[model samples]
Target: MCASACYEIGCALGDAPTRGTLALMLAGLLWYVGFIVVASILVSFGAVDSTRRPGYRRRDGKQEGTLMWPSLVMTAVVAASFAASHYSLT
Candidate 1:
């Protein structure tokens, strides 16, 4: 996904963007948007909820629940995307 966006941006900076490049850019944008939409759908459908800390177990009698993984994944995704969008070699 990142590669698609990067290539799209790089192509856009050229003198005259070709049809192929334009298609690539469109595809990249679609892929990026698709990911976000799918992710949101997954979250709403409880894909994220499954990763959330489970309820207390009644064997050794310990109540330990933490929503660390979901938080971390979300944070990392956002951070990586932000960095990619703002990245440059200027």
Candidate 2:
């Protein structure tokens, strides 16, 4: 959804330079790859588990792995995309 929105926004920017448009398109592609492909790989590697319920304490009371790294990577991707778009616009 967000990726498509980015692409649409890029397409709608008629006055923007070609580099800006291409940057947005590239950002959209990166969004898809980061969220879908990389996320899937992380899940397969046990880095993430979507089935776990929030605030649900396990019988063993063991703390589960944190999602900090995965989340940081996603955030970095978004930040990089934004930086690319900003630089292209300038």
Candidate 3:
């Protein structure tokens, strides 16, 4: 998803205003980097453990509920960015 957004944004550079394009590019880059840093910190702190225990089955139904919100927020950001880019081109 991020890769696709990056590609679309990159493809628009030639058409969008230089300032807006640069800002969008920088914002997208920062968002991905920030997400990675935050996820690393969470994992390091054991707030988001991914290890499996003995006898744990794939259908145990224990899911990581912490990721949904962040994923939704990220999707919204990407969608908004695309919308902004689209409108800016008009």
Q: Per-residue lDDT for 1-90 in model 2, tens only?
A: 335435544654565568756566555556655666665666675534545665644568754656657767776776675566545532
Q: After superposition, how far is residue 26 of candidate 1 from its true place, in Å?
A: 0.7
Model 2 accuracy (lDDT, Cα): 0.58
- TM-scores for every candidate against the unseen true structure: 0.40, 0.40, 0.44
Name the weakest run of 10 consecutive residues (lDDT summed) in model 1. 81-90
Report the CA-based lDDT of candidate 1 relative to the real structure: 0.53
Total clashes in model 2, counting residue pairs 3 or more apart in sequence or in different chains: 0
- Candidate 3 residue pairs in clash (backbone atoms < 3 Å): none
Better of 2 and 3 by lDDT: 3
Q: What are the per-residue Cα lDDT tens digits for candidate 1 across 6-47?
A: 555555545334776556555555655666675566566465
Task: Name the regions of candidate 1 deviating beyond 4 angstroms.
Answer: 1-16, 46-90
Number of the predicted model whose lDDT against the real structure is largest: 3
Worst lDDT 10-window in candidate 2: 1-10
The TM-score obtained by model 3 is: 0.44
Superposed Cα RMSD, model 1: 6.7
Q: In terms of TM-score, which candidate is strongest?
A: 3
After TM-score superposition, the amount by which residue 36's alpha carbon in candidate 3 deviates from its true location, in angstroms, is 9.0
